[model samples]
Target: MMKILVVDDDPNILELVNIHLSQAGYTVMKALNGFEALKLVEEDFPDLAVVDVMMPGMDGFTLTKKLRTEADIPVLLLTAKGELEDKEKGFLAGSDDYVVKPFEPKELLFRIHAILRRYDKAVDLFIQAGPMNINRQSYEVSVGKKVLLLPLKEFELLSVLASKPNYVFTREILIERVWGYDYEGDEQTLNVHIKRLRDKLEKLTAEVIISTVRGVGYKLEVSSS
Candidate 1:
């Protein structure tokens, strides 16, 4: 079971997060403040942390910064401060994501799941190709700091192809690797995904795009455009 730590000064919020997370089948731990949360980390690291920004001692920003500097753990900052500056500071402090106060529990749950999925799959959690940075754990693909939205299959396809730049992957190999050989879909499905991935990459002004080799498969290349 995955362990999740929830840090908040408000008893009600802590309770709510704990109940929902527990029901979601995670081992949920609670800390009323950042200090307690850090102490807990010393004993056993949680898979991910949902931290409130305001606390009596060791605010979430400080705690997040410390964790990022030392442990590379993922953090989601939950706070009422929704200003652009506040969000920027959270990112600068090493927060992986930020949620404002009074957020829908389901939204929180989804975000948590995405972040955890990224980390649980890959310990390094990030892949880079040209100007693109794909964060496997965060489910994020970015050019520099700007994140690009991608559909699930498209994202997976991009990851596979970008994992080895300029290396041709046969259609049979791609389907077997990405959709699985057992995938009952048409072989044409791979082409559709490739087209969409190419369009999205172009829209993002990515320096790389998928290049198809006639009678063969495809590879990602650094484009001059």
Candidate 2:
């Protein structure tokens, strides 16, 4: 069972999250403040943390930075302040995702599952092709001096192809892996994303190319030069 630490100043919020998470088959731990949460982590680290952004002493931003820098734990910031600045601050503080306080239970659960899925996908969690490095955890691709941040879907698509260089992935398999089984989009969607990726790669380096396999699908090829 995966352990999740939920930190919130309000007992009501803590209880609410605990109940929902527990019901979802996760071993849930609760803390009232950031200090307490950090202390708990010292004893037992969890797979992920759902943290509130408006605590008394250590605010959610500070707590998030601590959790990310010290424990390297993935965090989902839960708070009522649904402002653009707050969201930007959350991301800048190294939060993996953010959720407003009035968020749906199902949506919260889905986001938690998604974060855990990304966390569990790879051990190394990055692919290095020549000067380009595709980091799945950070969702950023760096080529030499330039770091490119692609959209989530584009990043996932690139990661999947780069995971196995020169190995052909058909459109069906790529769509299923990147967009999930229930992706209800036309085939043109994949083509658009692939074209975008190729355009970005062209700007980065000539050593790496996303090759088309004639009528099949796409493959990422890194030149040995």
lDDT of 1 by residue, 114-223 (tens): 78767763233577888888887778999866788788889888887877778777786577556754578887999999999988888876589899989988988976
Span of 10 residues, lowest total lDDT, candidate 2: 121-130
lDDT of 1 at 51: 93
Per-residue alpha-carbon lDDT of candidate 2 for residues 59-178, written as tens digits (9 for 90 to 100): 999999999999899999997988999999999999999999888776787788789888883223778876789887787899767999999889888887776677777787688667
* Candidate 2 lDDT score relative to the true structure: 0.86
In model 1, what are the clashing residue pairs, if there are any?
118-137
In order, what lDDT does every prediction score?
Answer: 0.82, 0.86
The candidate that achieves the highest TM-score relative to the unseen native structure: 2
- Per-model TM-score, in order, reads 0.54, 0.55
Candidate 1 colliding pairs, count: 1
